[model samples]
Target: MTSYNASLRARLMPIGLLLIAMSCIQGGASLATSLFPAVGPATATSLRLIMAALILWAIFRPWRWRVARRDWRDLLLYGIAMGSMNFLLYQAINHIPLGIAVALEFTGPLGVALWSSKSRFDLLWIAIAIAGLAVLLGLDHGNSDHTINLTGVLCALGAGGCWAAYILFGQRAGEVNGMQSAVWGITIAAVVIAPIGLVNAAPAITESHVLLIALCVALLSTALPYTLEMVALPRLPTQTFGTLMSLEPAFGALSGLLFLGQALSLLQWLAIMAVVTASIGTTVTGRSAEPIEAPYPD
Candidate 1:
């Protein structure tokens, strides 16, 4: 009985880690919204990526690791995808609520999961997801303040597309040590986002408070979650990991409500639930095409 209990604990620990990682990431995103006024979203994104890269590189010393020449293509793609995804997501949350933006962005991965499926049941899930999105975007909730922003929705969708690319390229790049690959990938992302951020909000980026908040965002959104996910992924089955990750939108909603005071209406809540169900169904049905290395949301 003692040996069995120990084995069960070991198995459960990774799931707990993944849940903690998702919560940290969603909470971090809510916190980041508070920084947008002080340092524009672009600048905040740049700072977060730069700080995350610095921390990861310091810990992993990716520079000390040798990379195969063949891996460079995938690494570059992964970095570009990561940078674009973060930048776009920040832009999205600036205009939309965190939970809604996350739900929209999740469609990218959902699309990937459905892309390879020949099952009729997958179509049902797809239709259900579309209905959820329609309700999310089109339903008259009787509050004029609840109107959806088309541009923000587009930005979230763009981020989702980039996320799909990240998953694909990450799979190839992740053949290297997880920490090392993350360091290099995040560093490259920082480099890519730097020029745009500087051009848009150079002076704001220099503020002491902005720097502090950016560092916190980096630790909460990237470093901690990435570390936890890396630890969890190898231990959990892909289906279990994906199902757990499906809770991210709900987590985002809760964090937004708690930290940002962004509340969802009943219809919106139903929409979120619909999307969540689709995601969970996809995972449970084994149609999810997620990478073995879990994707990180910033």
Candidate 2:
């Protein structure tokens, strides 16, 4: 009985780690919003990528690692997707609530989950995801309000699209060296994003407080959570990991409410849940789903 209990505990611990990782990521995103006004989303994104790269370099010492010439292509695409995903999502949360943005972004993964499905069962999940998106876009029942920011919605969807690309390419890149691929991806993301962001927000980028907040965002959203996820990855099945990650939108919503005071309506909450359900449904049944290793919505 004791041994059985120990086994149960071991199984559950990874889930706990994943939960904490998601929560930390959402909390980090909420915190990042506070900096959006001061430095703009572009600069904030640059800081996140740059700082995360530095942190990963320190820990992984990617300089010592050599990449296969064949793997470079996948790694390049993964980095582009990762950087673009972060930039677009930050643009998204700039105009809309974090929960809504996260829900919208989840469609990328949902679509990935359904990519090769010949299964009729997947249709129901697709319907759920579409319905959620429709409702959030205020397209259902032909009712959209001034409250909705179309640009934010579009950016979030784009971010989701990038996220799908990230997962597909990330799996390929991760095959060779595991999380060391992450260090490389992050370094590339920083290189790609820093110039664009710095060009846009030159004046505000140098403030001490901005640097501090960016550091915090880097730690909460990237460094700490990435470490936790790496630890949890081996312990859980891909299906279980995928299902648990579906909870991210809910955590994002709660973080917005708690830290950013972005209260969502009942209808919005339900829409987010619908997206989460679709994500969970598809990934639980999808043929090639896996845990996401990229940094989140920040």
TM-score of 1: 0.94
* Residue-wise C-alpha lDDT for candidate 1, range 1-298, written one tens digit per residue: 9999999999999999998998899888988887888778888888899899999888767888899898988899989999999999999999998999999999977887777555568977887788888877866455667789988999999999998888778888888766677778898899999778867685667878888888999999999998888788889987788789888888988888999998998888889889999888777774434444445856
lDDT of 2 by residue, 11-61 (tens): 999999999999999999998998888988889999999999999889989
- Candidate 1 at residue 188, lDDT? 88
Q: Least accurate stretch of 10 residues (summed lDDT) in model 2?
A: 289-298
* TM-score, every prediction: 0.94, 0.94
Pull out the clashing pairs in model 2.
none
Model 2, residue 106: C-alpha shift (Å): 0.6
Root mean square deviation (Cα) for candidate 2:
2.0
- For lDDT, the strongest prediction is 2
Task: Give the number of colliding residue pairs in candidate 1.
Answer: 0
